[model samples]
Target: MLKFIKGNLESIDGVAVYPIISLLIFFIFFAALFWWVFTAKKDHIKEVSNIPLELSENETNDKNDLPL
Candidate 1:
């Protein structure tokens, strides 16, 4: 399977550019994610981190009732 793909790509002109572009896209995505993590407000991060806890608390409290 690997050889088949390599053979097909080798026959295409400028196939190398595809990998470069993909790498650039992947790098940019992670870079943006890292920047967001660093720049996000402390309160926002704390709220997001407690999402699972909040859901569990609500479920426990609402177990005997139905939400509208």
Candidate 2:
């Protein structure tokens, strides 16, 4: 199976460029992600991290106010 696939790929023109292009794309995406993670504002990060807790608190408050 591997021999068959390799034989097919070897016949195609510019096939070698595909691997390099894919690698560059993968590298750039992670590089951008790393940069964003490092440069993101701490206050914004804290607010986003608290979103689930805020939602749960709101839900509890809403339930308590509901007519029993």
Candidate 3:
């Protein structure tokens, strides 16, 4: 099965660049995610952590407000 798939892929023109492009996209996505997680503010994290509890306050104050 693996050999069959490889044979099919190798026959296609410009197929080699697909793997390189996909790997670059995957690496960039994770790199950006890591950067965001490390650089995020503690205050923003704290506020986000309390999101569930904040929902109740909104429920009592403005029932008509959007859920999020």
lDDT of 2 at 34: 100
Evaluate candidate 1 by giving its C-alpha RMSD to the native, one decimal. Answer: 4.7
TM-score of each: 0.72, 0.84, 0.72
- List residue ranges in candidate 2 displaced over 4 A: 56-58, 65-68
Summarize candidate 1's per-residue lDDT along 1-68 as a digit string, tens digits: 99999999899999999889999999999999999989999999899899876657667778858766
The Cα local distance difference test for each model comes to: 0.90, 0.95, 0.90
lDDT of 2 by residue, 1-68 (tens): 99999999999999999999999999999999999999999999999999876657778899999998
Model 3, residue 14: displacement in angstroms?
A: 1.3
Model 2 alpha-carbon miss at residue 33, Å:
0.6
Q: After superposition, how far is residue 53 of candidate 2 from its true place, in Å?
A: 0.9
- Top of the candidates by lDDT: 2
User: How much is 26 displaced in model 3, in angstroms?
Assistant: 0.9
Deviation from native of the Cα of residue 16 in model 1, angstroms: 1.0
Q: Which ten residues in a row have the lowest lDDT in candidate 1?
A: 52-61
Best-fitting candidate, scored by TM-score = 2
